[model samples]
Target: MKKAALLSIAMLGLTACSQGVQTMTDRTASPCGDKPNCVSTQDNREKYQLAPFTLTANASLDNIEEVALKLPGAKTAVKEGGYLRIECTSRIMRFVDDLELKIDGRTLVVRSESRVGYSDFGVNRKRADQLREQLKQSGLIE
Candidate 1:
């Protein structure tokens, strides 16, 4: 009985930590939560807000996808219309973080958030910055 209860609790914890794409919309990536574990181009909070990537004339969703996939532990999980979702896992703890991108006219909106933690130790912000630099290097974004 004790073993069964422990198994159930473990499953519940994993389920909570594996949530994905909770607040995305057709036109934008999801907003950052009140926690510091997120950063988004659509967020109004100074600490959580990042500038949307300005797509160059030659840039496409394919270019963005290719650039994003080069990030550490990044894998494309969803691609539909102008939206793309990439799951990035931490190397040690294997914590999954959702990195979402939405094409909006000449720009790419972005949101990166941890699934379960209150603080990601700036991991989400660093991931976004790394992606931005790669996009710029590839001439995909200005």
Candidate 2:
């Protein structure tokens, strides 16, 4: 009975940590939850809201894809049409965070959220800011 209970708990933990692509439409990314572990350009909440990237005339989804892949511990999980999802793993705890991007005309929508956590210590926000800086430096975003 104890073994069974332990196994069930282990399975639950694993499930909570599992990473998957969030649904994104043409100009919308998934909204962040009430938790402090998320930040998104689509979220209107003051705490979770972030400014969307302004894409230059020459900017392409491919350019965003390249810059996203350059982020530390980032791996492409899905890339279809104008939507891209990247999984970023923490070097210490291996906690996975989902970073999603959607190209909407001349704007780029972005979201970053932890897969399993109530508070991410501002990791998601920092990641989004880092991405913004990188994209700016690459002449991709305004």
Candidate 3:
């Protein structure tokens, strides 16, 4: 009877382990079985990749704002103590609003939703035709 009870408990443990198992697709996205330990990209999909150009004033939000805007990476920044929304893409990333001045640090958060990726930022982009014309006139391009 003890042996049978041990086997039943083992089976229950195995079932519990598989309860929340999930599967995710990578860049190639072939069906891959994700274990229970797998972290869902959307369910746990809040992601950020931030580095400071120069963190001064003890990593307050303001100091880090501008340089991050000009660069390819800053996923988000604090402006006017409000969240500055940005969209990113491989070709270009653009600002969602004019600079807000609430930030006082150098560390920036490069974050995104599960449905959003850096490449999706291109949808909102427009080329700088004026700059292109200037460059052409300057003989920078044929």
Candidate 4:
């Protein structure tokens, strides 16, 4: 009983340490906050840099938004201009990760980052890739 209680408390403490959304500046999403739990086309760091995907002729902002919403634990948190911000929670721990998709010219730029912690075991990267695949499968991206 004592061990279980201690474990619960430790998990709660870790969850409480997660930070929320960081500010985005200009037309780019914020860079990773000294953490490996983030990846973005806006970031120049080799570990964080991801290529922006080109949009298909049939793709619209709504189509991309729909693809994001279909992902597990994902919800649209904000939509403005050509940017869509999504929040995804972990299945068990409920840790939140933020994903931003921006329409820059003819390409779609994506940024995914964990709300807290220095490592995410590649969850953010995998999530981004999953989203990209969904877009492609749905003919939203080429």
Candidate 3 clash figure, as a count: 12
Between 2 and 4, whose lDDT is larger? Answer: 2
Q: For each candidate, what is the lDDT?
A: 0.87, 0.86, 0.30, 0.83
lDDT of 4 by residue, 1-142 (tens): 9999999999988767644456544334667767789888888888888877899888887889999998879998788889888889888877888888889778998998877777999998898889989999999888
Q: In candidate 3, where is summed lDDT lowest over 10 consecutive residues? A: 24-33
Report the number of the highest-TM-score candidate: 1
lDDT of 3 by residue, 63-135 (tens): 3343334434334422345234332333332222111122223322223222223332322212122222332
Report model 1's TM-score to 2 decimal places. Answer: 0.83
> Distance from true position, residue 27, model 2, in Å?
11
Candidates 1 and 3, the one with greater lDDT: 1
Predicted candidate 3, C-alpha RMSD? 17.5
> In model 3, which runs have C-alpha deviations exceeding 4 angstroms?
1-58, 73-78, 92-110, 113-142
Candidate 1 residue pairs that clash: none
Clash counts for the predictions, in order = 0, 0, 12, 0
lDDT by residue (51-141, candidate 1, tens digit) is: 8789999988888999999999999888998889898988887788888888889989998888777999999999999999999999998
